[model samples]
Target: MGRPCALREKEVERVFSTPTIQQINSDYAEFFNLVGNNTGVDLSENGFRDITTVVDFLYIQVSYRIYYPPLPDWTTEGNVKCNNNPIIPCKDKTVYEIMKEMNDLRFYVMYNSTELHKLDGGSVLTDIGKKFGEYVAGNRSVTYNIYSAHDSTVSAVLTALQISDAKQPEYTATVMVELHKSAGDAQGHEVKVFYKPITDNSSIEEKNLPGCPSPCKLEDFLQYVKRFEISDWDKECGNNVPTTPAPPSTDSLGLTHQEKITIIACSTVVVVFCLILLIMFVRKRSSRSMAPYLSLGTGA
Candidate 1:
């Protein structure tokens, strides 16, 4: 973790140096530059180390307001006035207006500027599609499946689904998929999607998936999501996994059958020759010992 950035520059460059992010970063810097020019005070004086600092601060406010409404409001903590600061762009704007603008900007930065949702959101879409498939086949017994995911997850899914009004999902926002079976003359299954915003828990907004009917048929829904479904995530993300080679087979030990037979014959011949030499040595020892015994008997 303490490694130098220079060493891992190539690995992380794609994230920071993408053309879309670069353009957004440029725009971000220009906004800060205008603020600095008019205020006669460097906003960077307050630990604004990078161009993303101001945008990140605004996002933090938005996030806190939605995610933790019970918490004390940080924006009004220091008697801060919207109109007193000429550098502040959202002068005389309500908190809701500020959040809305930031949310829109966040959505643009995350999805609108690039085709990243196709890559990042593919897995979530695939899982949802599989669930629909399972529900139709009666394979899934559980009725409700919940995914505790980040806002990016919601945005990516919406973008991948080609929802025309796709924007950044607020904190505690939910995306639900409902599978309904026709009761009467209608014999086909239908899929319905609903999004519940954090602002109103009681209200669930029904969305019309682009290129599909309001109550999309199970078959059409599956086909529509097929484009965004990811089968091999690692391959799609360009993650290369090392593979081990299989062991060689015993039948073919890199030698011809004739060569193996010749080896066996040579080994047999060597074993038989060693056995013959051992027998001859044993006989020679026996003959010498018998001669000594006969000489002793003759001398007696």
Candidate 2:
């Protein structure tokens, strides 16, 4: 591991000029830390691991709601509207105008489910143990099966692994698998798997760890991440992703010649004012020094 660098306040300010981006990045790190703490898992340990491979997936679940009319009327008008806009339409009736709405509903369900999964997955003890094993294996340069995923992803992995307890509430768990090898022992290898419950406010707290590598604020992290994502997209999509041009500035706002002249004149006036003040300050100090000398000469 490289030596950690400490960033001063001014350095942080210089790196992250924009407040919003700084806030977002801070929040993101905080969220990650919180998840780690709640689960009693230290993801930072994994940070030290030589991460050779990364796999990502989503876990999914379906929910249902019963459709009922206001007056319990099953007549054609009521039935048509109900069929057309049922509170919860059947899988087949979800078509045409309702398709967009259904898609939106499904998206929301997936998002919420994923969030819940992350929360639960973070706190599970079994998951943390498996993660630690993976970390050890990675550090030892062993070809180990390691997995890190969100809640939905965990559920899906568990289901795929044919783990019996893969249901909600009772079977909720953070699924993990790992392989490890002993240092300097080519043939010494170990494989492990486990699951744990998701909990809130889980995180591993670090004391005396090296500070941030650079004087990076939240904005700096955002810009770094953004550039990374854009570069990745460019590599993946080739020519499909068009490069965006920089936006026009104040100079490109179609200002008239006279307005431009006025702005320049105003800036010149401010500069002149500052120079005048500086000159006056120098003169005042000179006069004050001379006053004492003149008084001493007259008294003598």
- Tens digit of per-residue lDDT, candidate 2, span 1-300: 011212222232333334532333343343324334444445333211101111110012122122332211211111112222233343343212222332333322322322222222322323434444455546545443444444445543343223324233212344434344534567554334445554343532221102222222322223322221222322432324557887544457787667888999999999999999999999999998887443445553
The alpha-carbon lDDT assigned to residue 149 of candidate 1 equals 82
The global C-alpha lDDT for each of the candidates, from Candidate 1 onward, is 0.59, 0.35
Candidate 1's residue-wise lDDT over 192-297, tens digit each?
9888877555887788987776688788888877776556555555655567787644455786667788899999999999999999999999998888443445
**What TM-score would every model get versus the actual structure?**
0.57, 0.22
* Error at 203, model 1, angstroms: 2.4
Query: Quick one: best lDDT, which candidate?
Result: 1
lDDT of 1: 0.59
How many clashing pairs in candidate 1?
Answer: 0
